[model samples]
Target: MVERCKACGFCVEFCPTKVLALSSAFNSKGYHPPHVVNPEKCSGCDLCGMYCPDFAIYGYKLETGQAHVATAASAVHRAQRGPGNQSTGVEDEG
Candidate 1:
């Protein structure tokens, strides 16, 4: 999904899954936003949004031609705890 990222790189640097990377292209603000370097590596966890200062980016789980935002408060908790959080446990309501 396209995001209005500010190119802070927080999403890339803090992403546990490391699916994101700085794109060669620059944003309107002249900063290079992160891109999907490996779509296969993405887990659609909202950890990127947790640390984003601009609140410009977040990930969504694509299912049945629809996208659901991975937004459980526990998602941040699970991220801090460890891996195996491939989908942010979408049903975990914190």
Candidate 2:
């Protein structure tokens, strides 16, 4: 999947799972937006998207009696990090 990021970094500031981070380089807009630097600790909760000003991140999950839920933020996390999250970062709520 394409990053579809504008490098606004708003998602990073609002990511509850802290799965996203600001890239060192800038995007086409010359902004350093958040990205899935670790792809292993995402909880697929979609908190970031819920608070994103530009909806840069997305997450998705399948519920199979595991209590997992599919969300735009969760889908974005899954797209980059897969199903398991092993990384850790600061928990910022927008």
Candidate 3:
């Protein structure tokens, strides 16, 4: 959030959890930028950064159940998503 975002809707569209929303205020360029409307629901997927043409916004996976960037959170997300392995399409049976 240091540089001015160019109001490219890529981040908002690519956000898996739909955490971003266009703000009512405009940037220096007079374009409606986005803001985190739902931080708690974010998973730090970073899809926004990958899609953002301006490289203005990015998200960090929060695993501590708190709304902030943390290294531990990233580790937790990695563990949850996959441990460098693809799903085998086999369901676990208890």
Q: What's the TM-score of each model vs. the native?
A: 0.58, 0.54, 0.61
List of clashing residue pairs for candidate 1: none
Q: Residue 78: error of model 3 in Å?
A: 17
Cα lDDT tens digits, model 3, 1-94, are: 4235667677778788786776676656677767666555556767777777775666564453333212101211122244453222211111
Tens digits of per-residue lDDT for model 2 on 1-94? 1235565566677766566676565556566655465455556666766766565555545352121222222222223333564233323222
Could you give me the TM-score of model 1 versus the true structure?
0.58
Instruction: Assess candidate 1 and give its lDDT.
Output: 0.53
- For lDDT, candidate 1 versus 2, the one ahead is 1
Structural RMSD, model 1: 9.8
Whole-model lDDT per candidate: 0.53, 0.49, 0.53
Q: What is the model-wide C-alpha lDDT for candidate 2?
A: 0.49
Candidate 1 lDDT at 68 equals 32
After superposing candidate 2 on the true structure, give the runs of residues whose Cα lies further than 4 Å from its correct spot: 1-8, 63-94
Candidate 1 C-alpha lDDT tens digits along 1-94: 2335566677778888786677676656566666555544556667877787876566765553222333212121113223553333234322
Candidate 3 structure lDDT:
0.53
Model 3 error, position 86 (Å): 30
Model 3 bad stretches (over 4 Å):
1-3, 62-94
Error of 1 at 66 (Å): 8.9
